[model samples]
Target: MARRILQASFVRRAALSAGWLAGLHTLAGCAPTLPVVVAPINCPVSAEQLARRCQAPQAIANGATYGEVLQLHQLDRKALRDCAAHDRLLAEMIVQCQRTILDYNDRLVEINRRIADKP
Candidate 1:
């Protein structure tokens, strides 16, 4: 009777250990994912986009009366101001992009210099 009980207990422990090992083996498949590669940023402002964004408003007709012409001049001045503001913004954006490119180039040059100097 004692020998039979011992045999049964050994069988039960062995079965549990096998099941645990099998579960761990299946779980190992979840690791080791592939790395993702990213493309470089190429955000150039297109000519078509510039043409569409900063277009001038329709031309105003010449006024008949002196007061009317003065009011028209005011309107024309405001339109010019708006156009100038848009142009300044575009210029600033171009300068900023140039600065960014130059900054990155400098960094890359430094990195290359350091790598070349390494033993």
Candidate 2:
């Protein structure tokens, strides 16, 4: 009788967990989806704006922002050798362009706050 009771309790707990997992999946499925689109173009400097406009093709030329780049600063020796053969300036420009975007966003937020305070 004791063994029977233990088995019943285990089955009940397992069923509860299964039901909870199903509910989580249903909730996740209800989330709104984002569209896959090209990145925005709004650089403060026209040179940087042109660079932003040309980023995709430049990235392809540099071949530096691939799956391997996600490994952080630890690049494979062979890959680094290959990248050195390509246009290093392209990668540098991309990094600078991204930094400019972050700075621009910060300045815009500050300017909007000042404008809002007037009225």
Candidate 3:
């Protein structure tokens, strides 16, 4: 009887260990993943730069106005769609453009926050 009890306890411990290992394996499989290749930050121009250029005298002389914002939106949408259809290299350029614009905007937002926080 004593030997049987000892064997049963060992079996229970083995089963528990197996269960724990299986759970860990499952958790490892579900671990969050990050992109292996980070997007490059090689943008020469940004959305703000584009906006400023669009407001320049040449653009204004071409009949640009405040209401031309809609036209800008349409142009941007068309360019994005074209980029989406481009081959891998062009597509990467498009993504880089987007990242650069976003990085610029993030910096602009931080600057605004700091200005607002000034006493």
Candidate 4:
């Protein structure tokens, strides 16, 4: 019957797929794995470096002209912005490093599982 033939074909295809997957797994297991060493993430500017990079403008002298005070305020705002930019950069670096560490831990778990399952 046609139904019987279809069932037989399906079974054959399933068996072939299973065998192919097993062969691929065997081949992957035979690959040479090298050691993976991850260096620690570095993300911090020293106090001196930070001070040198972002020093706010000194306060205007007493009885200063309006223009001088305005200029000083603008410089102070720019300095604050520069400091915030540095902090944001550092925060992004930390986030990326944390994600990488998490992924590395996950891969390590999978590797351990495969090692344990190996014959």
Candidate 5:
């Protein structure tokens, strides 16, 4: 009877450990994979210029009046339209920079929403 109890306990512990490991394996498989981003090479534009242009929209988004927002949108549209006529690589960079600015604006909107939600 003593030997049987010991063997049963060992079996139970083994099964528990196997279940735990299987759960971990399932979770590892479900984990999201990170995206890989590559930077452009041999570009004509300087990083400083890109950074400055990118920040332009964010500055407006941060503290612009309704009229300023309208003006900024017009300016952004004109700039992107002009960029579309340039070299393909430069146009792509301009579009990417515009996307970054829009994304920043989206985050700022979300932050404002959260702040307004707070008591």
Candidate 6:
């Protein structure tokens, strides 16, 4: 009777060990994931240069236009020139220029999203 009890205890321990190992094996099959990385946007001109150009009217009316701003990936020079030509305050021009920079950045983000969403 003692031998039978020992055998039963051994079998129960083996069954428990097998169950625990099976659970571990199942968990091992599911691997941990890493965060996804995205590429940065490449702009042609710096924000400071764009802001300075926006503050200068002659620079805008002479050659700077919306097309030029878009091509250079800069602020809206024409809008800045219009504001300056209308005798807007220097502070206002700066604000408008900064707003233009934000607009440009938003546009670039949208473009990047569209490109990324392509099938």
Model 4 agreement with the true structure over 13-49: per-residue lDDT tens digits: 9999999999999999887664464455444445555
- Pick by lDDT: 1 or 4, better one: 4
The count of backbone overlaps in candidate 1 is 0
Which candidate comes out best when scored by TM-score? 4
| Candidates' C-alpha lDDT | 0.72, 0.61, 0.65, 0.77, 0.68, 0.64
Q: Clashing residue pairs, candidate 5?
A: none
Clashing residue pairs in candidate 2, if any?
Answer: none
For model 3, where is the 10-residue window of minimal lDDT?
A: 52-61
- C-alpha lDDT of candidate 6 relative to the true structure: 0.64
| Model 6, residue 30: C-alpha shift (Å) | 36
Per-residue lDDT tens digits for candidate 2, residues 28-78, read 987654334335555333454344322121122356666646553344444
How far in Å is the alpha carbon of 44 misplaced in model 6?
Answer: 19
lDDT of 6 by residue, 35-107 (tens): 3434444444445544553344334356677787565444446666665754445556567767777876787
lDDT of 5 at 89: 58
Cα displacement (angstroms), candidate 3, residue 54, comes to 30
TM-score, candidate number 5: 0.31
Q: Look at candidate 1 and tell me the lDDT of residue 5.
A: 100
Report the Cα lDDT for residue 38, model 2. 32
Candidate 5 deviant stretches above 4 angstroms = 1-86
Which digits, one per residue and each the tens of the lDDT, describe model 5 over residues 59-90? 46676789988888888877776555544656
Candidate 4 off by > 4 Å: 1-53
- Two-way TM-score contest, 1 vs 4, winner: 4
Q: What TM-score number comes out for model 3?
A: 0.30
* lDDT leaderboard ranking: 4, 1, 5, 3, 6, 2
Residue-wise C-alpha lDDT for candidate 1, range 1-119, written one tens digit per residue = 99999999999999999999999998987655333422344546667657855445445565567776777788777888888887887788788878877876776777677657655
Task: TM-score winner between 3 and 6, please give it.
Answer: 3
Task: Give the least accurate 10-residue stretch of model 1, judged by summed lDDT.
Answer: 33-42
- What is the full ranking by TM-score, best candidate first? 4, 1, 2, 5, 3, 6
Where's the lowest-lDDT run of ten residues in candidate 5?
34-43
Q: What is the lDDT of residue 78 in candidate 4?
A: 88
